[model samples]
Target: MSSRHSRRSHGHSSGRNSRRTTQNTAQLIESLNTHRVNTLTELCRIERVAATASDEDQLAFQGPMTSAWTYYVTSNNLLSELRGLTRNYPFSSDALDDAKWRVSNDPESNRSWNYAWLVLIKMRDDQMVEAYAASEAAKPEMWGGRVPEAEEARQLAECFAWEWNEALEQMLRHWDTPPTTTGY
Candidate 1:
């Protein structure tokens, strides 16, 4: 082949590859946005159902709540993937900032807090659960009593509360520092 022909072919190939890359990045960003919206929707649905559930029906809501929690966690993963994909892209800075703002302002962002609060309220309204908790509370020794399912639920709620506080503290610390150019 002639040198000029070879050079032209190579240039064309490179241009095609660049265009493909750009297209893929745009698609990924769109997917990230879709995932974010879906996650938020699921979170809101779970919150609404849990909030409106009666004491008798609250137990039935647990599965949906757990599913929402899993989706929320998955949303975080999608956000991380988005950050990685856009790290060196020209428009990443604004995109990343907007994403972080969306996350920070998400209605159900505080999963642990909301879950804990809902569980506590549900348990409080359940007479059987409250009786179990009260009996356990009356025990002289902290570790000696048999933990009823209700008490276990309360403990789980408390753990969620702890996780919520820890996450909040981490967010605060992260915000205190200037944005670093390192990891996404």
Candidate 2:
């Protein structure tokens, strides 16, 4: 329906125009698919051995959407921090919900750990190899003490990737035009 970069400035420049029209939408979609597949594989591998303590390893897994939500939350927080927020933004539903809970239970803890909680618990724990690698030992437990299985993680990653890409595409499409202004 809408195309992103329609025209260039000044002159025609045949070579430049050719490359501009060579839309990479298909390539981008393929890349997204590959990312999802790779993410799912990594998730499956890590979930096998997340818990350090005995008997803590057998917790039931979460469904896909929740898992993917965790991934999005973690990724978003990382991106936000890289961009430098004066105060951390709530990047995930889980983090936001935790913050809400803290507002009632312990509001003071809401700032830092909420973001970290989603990252370690939801994102890192999904990968089994990443769990026992010593580095993750320092990671906090947001689930109280639960680990999602590979299947759950995969479904979550795939679903989240699909939904997110779709939403992003939609947003990009809407960016083509500015909103009309009406005044009295």
Candidate 2 residue spans exceeding 4 A from truth: 1-145, 177-184
Candidate 2, pairs of clashing residues: 45-128, 46-127, 46-128, 46-129, 47-128, 64-156
lDDT of 2 by residue, 88-159 (tens): 211234433343343336433333222233333333224322222222222234224556555555544454
Per-candidate TM equals: 0.28, 0.21
Candidate 1 stretches greater than 4 Å from native: 36-71, 74-180
Residues 1-184 of candidate 1 have per-residue lDDT tens digits of 6999999999999999868755644443344344443443334443454444455444544554545444444445433433333333211222223434544565544444333222322332332233333443434453465444666656744443343334333332322222112211
Worst 10 residues of 2 by lDDT: 175-184
Task: Provide the clashing-pair count of each candidate structure.
Answer: 0, 6
The stretch of ten residues in a row with the least summed lDDT in candidate 1 is 175-184
